[model samples]
Target: MDPICTLAVVGAGTAGCVLAARLSEDPNTKVLLIEAGDRMSYFTKIPLTPTVAQQGPYDWSVRTTPQKYSSFGLWNQSQIIPRGKGLGGSGQINFMMHGVGLPKDYERWESLGFKGWSFKDLRPYFVKAFGTASAECDPEMCSADGRCPYSSIRFENKKAASIYILKNHRELDNIFVNKEIVLAAGSVKTPQILMLSGVGPEKLLKKLKIKVIARNEQVGKNLHDHMNTPVYVSIERPISITLSKIFKFNTLWDYVWNRKGLLSFPPMAGVEYFGNSALMLFAMGSASERLMRDLSNYKHEVFRKTFPFHHSSSKEGFIFLATCTQPRSRGTVSLSDISTNTPPLVNPNYLQNGRDVKCIVKALKRIIKIVSSKPFRDIGAKIHWPRPERCQSFWNGSRTSKKIPKPAKTLNKDLVKRTTVAENDKKDRVKMNTGNNFVSDDYLECVVREVAVTGHHAGGTCAGGTVVDHKLRLKSVTGVRIMDASVMPSPTSLYPNSVLVSMAEKAAEIIKHDPAIHHDTLQKTTDRRGGGRKCVKHVRQNGLQADQVYIAQAQVSENKTKDANRCGINSAFYRKKFAEVNTIKTTQQCH
Candidate 1:
């Protein structure tokens, strides 16, 4: 006989794991979590191994169709969009940076008619999702040194989140849902899965010859991602992380024996946000020519001379990653073929909006200023110009010559001294001159068009108010709820994982409160324990309707008492409503 569960959650990603763990807290509720991929690879446990893990079976890295306005320097003018495969999903193969997003981000969702999703309502879930891990450290202390002391800057679960959830729950891997299904398959794959399951835009489903269970015009539309471009700087000293340091025997020994060392941390050390732009610092350790080419798909000849095996004598470098937090450009995810084996076509229409280009350019200038700042300069860091041949004309020198003059110190100094205005400020403005300035705005814009790639924070596909209702219920269909990044009404200013986890926590509570799932379960449990008749009689005697009395029949068990409390009724209130239901003597009698 097949095992049956009250709820089934698809895609064991960040939200899926959280939903499974939180929903399964009820002893009466059975939750079956499903993941298309296998368990996460062991290497995923190490913080610095996402790059290596991404190359393995744990990743679902895909290439975008030649971007219309960006990725000109990459091979075929396309960008690589990496998604994680396996239990943890993308969270397993991502840079472990924690970000909660700004309060206004959610307020905007509320403004869009997504009621009960404002920052104030979601704040409790955010604290619950982060848990005690946040309580152990002081944000001010971590910020002082430009490095957080925590071994990993991610949510509490460092391993595949399902592993943590299942280890404590002892649940089944596969089962049928008797009540409802929750889809947490992430933004990219969730839409794909929905389309494949005959629920998506009617036109696309018809073209693919799929049986249409539901026609939603908004399933795969409104796809947006954070776009990032790296500004590389060579470090003159060997103090930064390097391949030599990573391969040292002591490094491995310390990680294996004591679980602390260079390998204990992520390669991308820290991140800071300013206005709508964010700067992520990567310890670009001893970048080889091949590695550089792989990281940023610059022209081969340009990459060869521009960033050699080791740019400086120390063979160490760092990357200032400038990210446009709020991108206006939208893209789409569509099924290329009917078969689930075929990956969906992704068109990240990056930098198509003039605003996105301008945002990234400003961030790039900010990176240049940071590299020239006292802190970076103290480490002997020097900027490396990645002037591909196509963009050579934008620079200061002759377009034909390989020799280029140093960037203008005046421009860097000016940018450093300038106080940035808020995004909403009408006075926010900057004047530009593309003429013979050492590194002009034209050059920065050209670089952005050539090199920017997805920050891997894709979302807003199965958006709220469009595809799903405020409660995350799929509008076009019944018995289905979408609880993941896909339900985000807009792109967040930071990593979406933190927001996704919090959403799941809140979603679980919302699902629990559903009268259908809870009422039926509670009614059956009361009957099985022979307390339903007594409860109904007590309610009738007290001039209360039988349906209004939602009682939990239990005895001397802490878990049962907690479960009863979760029903939204207190012991005193229940006693006042029904004094002698099922012959219970006191409030403690139920426990």
Candidate 2:
């Protein structure tokens, strides 16, 4: 006999996992988790799996429609967008660097008039949920099962699935949504599923012969990603994570038994210089570090990719990942075919904007300077030239399958004389993001359009300002919610896996607390408080918090000093503190 579940959650990735784990805590409420891929296993436990996880059985080898302006490095064709196919989803194949979105990003949602969706409002949820994949339970803090056990092996008996055969797969489970349904599939597939399930723009759904469930004009629109310019540099001392360390017999043995070693190190371990939150002051001509402390949004960053140590000839390397924060380009995921067998058409429209190219080029130049600095030189790290040559498949002629070979000469200077834009105005063009002889605005643009890669932080499809409400419910559909990265209104300032997990944690709480949801059976989330959430309260943002709007409002005041005093309190303190420190240094120098 098949027992009906109180909730049905789609996709068993990060968000899906959290939804299933948290929702099933109540003995009276049954949860069904539907996943397309098999259970998590087979090298998924390893931390440094990004380099090897692709092209394997677990990766959905999805490609974008060839770009006219971006992805120039991929043989002038569509970029290969990798999506994980297993239960863990991208968390299995990702670089494993966890960073949250900036406070301003969440404030943008509040600015758009969506309440209960700010960084302040969400921070408590983040702190309360998702800690150490293993259990971290305090008997006084939680009930016996309040700690969510992350191991798939441990939860084998908990959920049900459809479209895949398992011990609990039901033949008649063609439709879900008895009590409520949540789409935790990522930005890519969530839109695809909604469209295929007949809940998208009416005109498109009609063409695909899908029965219209909801008319949503914004289902798959406003899609964007963190476009990055990656510069690979060789380690001077040659001590970095290598492929041999990841796959060697001892490493395998260590993980199989003890689950500890270099194999356990996250991708953030590769960062040798600055962090992921790099401002473009150096690239944008800020004369002093103190001068640019208040400025942000140019998230050009540096980090390292694991090296293939088996090839001893190759030096251990680090990757400087330059990012264009708040990219202007937007795209859509539409139906190329209605069949589930055919993957959805994902067009990120990478680097379509001229500004995105300039920002990335400037950021790349900053990385070059970082490598040339005394600190990098002291460490023996050098920018590996023509790095695209190392990967033949991703080389210059990738579309044509003819790899671009390395050039023998090296131009190691700090700056090049190329212009920022190919604008009609020659003066503006000359003032572009400068690079060394090896990289010019022209050269970097070509590199950018061709070689720039994604931060894999794709979002904004089911945006809070458009498609979904602040509660993450579909605008046109009832009894449905989205609790994945796909529902993010915009791409965060950081790598977004942590944010996605935080979102799941929050969404679970929101669902459990809503009076209208499961009114008869499910009690308030406070009915039981074994976890850390009992200590935190969801605070609401009552006033305006949009940065641009605040700035604009302050600018309207006739008295400049009064406006500055009112709005720029933090900046004023920083500048004053900087001056005092500089004064002390000057006095010491004179002595």
Candidate 3:
């Protein structure tokens, strides 16, 4: 028989590993971590086999709705949204080009009403996760005070982790929760689980004939991913680690014997090419004060402002890559079927916003400059950009043999009615019969619409002030809280695995200490500060059964004012803002 536990954390990925390990430290709370797949394997240990690892049983193999503005991918499929199925999640299959966001981004969150999410609040978690950056990266490659202080990607799977893995729950069954269920299943599936459990937008739920437990309209809105556009480059000599090298036996011996080969390094690891989003856009498209002013209004702006570039690291010459580090376009994650057995309809809606299109256009221009730079010139590197009329040939390959990106599929009639923006854009868009340049706006926009893909970082589904509160609790629900990329008001500054680990660290801290014995210790902090206390009564949710006796009181001191602020306790600002629930709930009216 399975032993019951205090906390049931779903998804034994990066976030679940951290949460389960940290939460289990308190012997009083038994953690039941559930995953749809098996534990860590040998392939995850090998940093070089990212592509191979993603193809096997460990991958979720999700694809978006055929993209309207971007190529779906080869073999008549939408672009793949790669999600890891086993332990370690995407961390197991990710390229391991680890990174974090700018500190100022958190500060911006504070200004935007996320009080406890400032850099000062989240810095300790970042330090706990990845340690710190040691020194500034190369000046030419970096645009800021770049510091990659430390490297801690050595895999250690056997550190008091999980012992059991339950792939799925039975149909029409109830999960008995002692305290709460923590949803850290990640951005893609967390919302799916919630909607399946009947907590999501009422319309979406109603459409699928699923019973609605809560009316959280923003359950899967605000989905964002880094927009990536790759330009293949040709170098005169063998400088980068490429596919040609992988075909050779000598390269294998170099990796196995000396650990000094292409396999050991992630794509464009130490070397960098960073450019500011605002500056590059201005440099490329000339000045538009409206566009520059519009930059600050975006949460994507709070992300890494500079676009980071890398190489395909191929022998014939590597591919020069450009990514819109922060994209303004937003998408949604919706239910395809009522069953959890089906994957959610994930639509990152890549390049829905005109601003994101403009951003990537600038990014493509930047890639051209990098190839043109003297350093690249010395290495005989030139951009091998493949457009509709272009293809790579060792000895003047024929255009007919080239892989042409097939035209995007026709818009779904239902999707067409809902997506007025696309129809309008399509109507106004003039077909370019002629006009192709290595660095032209129209040329690049065509490439982006045809070949641009996601950086595989989808986040900001259950964002703050939307589906969940600042504490990541599902609005109008109790005994549940979210802990994943979906809760992030926006995507992280860089690759989000480390940041997800840190967030789990912080979330585990919250779960363990909430209404626990530590209140006595926290009480003293208030005493030391000579702060007054208030017993703040907040309904876990208002619309409950008339006989429902769900009452939770939060005893907050001035030291913990942020908690009170979030719950609408003594803060007059919040009280006035939420005047509907100012005094107290009348049981008769509430029910």
Residue 489's lDDT in candidate 3:
73
Flag clash pairs in model 2: 72-449, 72-450, 73-450, 73-451, 75-399, 142-530, 236-380, 416-435, 420-432
Clashing pairs for model 3 are 101-493, 133-148, 133-149, 134-148, 134-149, 241-313, 242-313, 242-314, 242-315
Arrange candidates by lDDT, highest first: which order? Answer: 1, 2, 3
- By lDDT, the best candidate is 1
| Global lDDT of each candidate | 0.62, 0.52, 0.51
Candidate 3, superposed: residue stretches over 4 Å from native: 1-3, 72-77, 111-113, 132-175, 247-250, 270-314, 389-438, 516-591
Query: What is the alpha-carbon lDDT of model 1 when measured against the actual structure?
Result: 0.62
How many Å off is the CA of 395 in candidate 1? 1.4
TM-score of each: 0.75, 0.67, 0.66
List the pairs of residues colliding in candidate 1.
556-591
Model 2 spans > 4 angstroms off: 1-3, 130-133, 136-172, 244-260, 270-313, 387-438, 522-591
Candidate 2: 10-residue stretch with minimal lDDT: 582-591
TM-score, structure 3 vs. true: 0.66
Number of clashes in model 2? 9
Please give the distance, in angstroms, between residue 70's alpha carbon in candidate 2 and its true position after superposition: 1.2
Which lDDT tens digits does candidate 1 get at residues 1-591? 122356767766777766765666665665655555554555766767656666466666777778889988778887776776655567777777667788889888887667888888989987765552111111221111110000000011111111101111121112234567787877887788778767788998899787777789989888889888776777767777777788899999998888788877778888877778788888865666656567556668756545555443347787777888889899898888864446678887888898988887777777756766688788787777666677877775444444433333333456445634232121211222212225666778887887676788888889998898999987766677888888887887868876787888889899988887776552232323443221111111111111111112112222432211211011111111111111111111111
The root-mean-square deviation over C-alpha atoms between each candidate and the true structure, in angstroms, is 14.6, 18.4, 17.9
